[model samples]
Target: MDIITSHPRIVKMKKNDITLYISTFPLETEDDFLEKLKETFDVEEACDGKNMAECFAIIYGGIVISKNSIFKRIELEGYFKESDKGIEFEINRFLENPYNCYTFDNGTICFIKNKEKDSRFVDNVGLRFIIK
Candidate 1:
């Protein structure tokens, strides 16, 4: 799925017709977001991954308004909502439970959620990556 289109915004999920880019904090990709984030990783390595980071960034209003976005920091691995767009159904961050997404300010998206909190990070993205 070489999504060379303007934005990967599908507007509806094939499975449930779930509306896209209607998140609380704006998940829509902006026009220049690709260029802004292009600096963070190797072009091929960065854009090419299961995390679908680039796809999500592109479709979900690609503009990274803040340098503090989770994408700028870690290698988040997960399955994409739309295999073509690269949005690996991670989390809205606002609607999802803190246990499913990364809750630490130090900058880290947790892949594993442990109940034992040693005054460290918190898992808000849940136990699994939502593979479907």
Candidate 2:
């Protein structure tokens, strides 16, 4: 899939010194796969504390696709302890879905379909996000 570097209204969030990137899944600009994301994730902008949170509906082609939310924060000693647990819990809860899965590489989040055999339709998907 192609990487989208920037967009007009993407949202960025920072917690415990770790940055979170969030953005809308463009339905028309890319290909049909993104359209699927738009249909499933219903990504939109919103606010969470001083940070920005993207509200999304997880859907797959007219079907309500199951999903989970993931948040990652820097594991600082006292100042960020609670925040780290909350973020990790959220990520774990989202990953528990049978049809969806996610992984964090360093701090980058990757959401994927949990299927044994991969198809082109699934392989063609891309994730959208913004960094502060």
For each candidate, what is the lDDT?
A: 0.28, 0.28
TM-scores of the candidates are: 0.17, 0.19
Q: Per-residue error at 2 for model 2, in Å?
A: 21
Clashes by residue pair, model 2: 21-130, 22-130, 40-59, 41-57, 68-94
* Model 2 error, position 59 (Å): 23
Model 2 reaches what TM-score against the true structure? Answer: 0.19
Best by TM-score: 2
Tens digits of per-residue lDDT for model 1, 29-125: 3444343344443434435542343344343432121222244212222221211122233335523432333222223332223434322221112
- Compute the lDDT of residue 89 as modeled in candidate 1: 33
Q: Relative to the unseen true structure, what is the C-alpha lDDT of residue 107 in candidate 1, on a scale of 0 to 100?
A: 30
What ranges in model 2 sit over 4 Å off? 1-8, 25-132
Candidate 2 residue-wise lDDT, 1-132, digit = tens: 433322222223333433334332333344443444444543331111222222221111111121234433221111100111122314335435413222333332333333233211221122444324
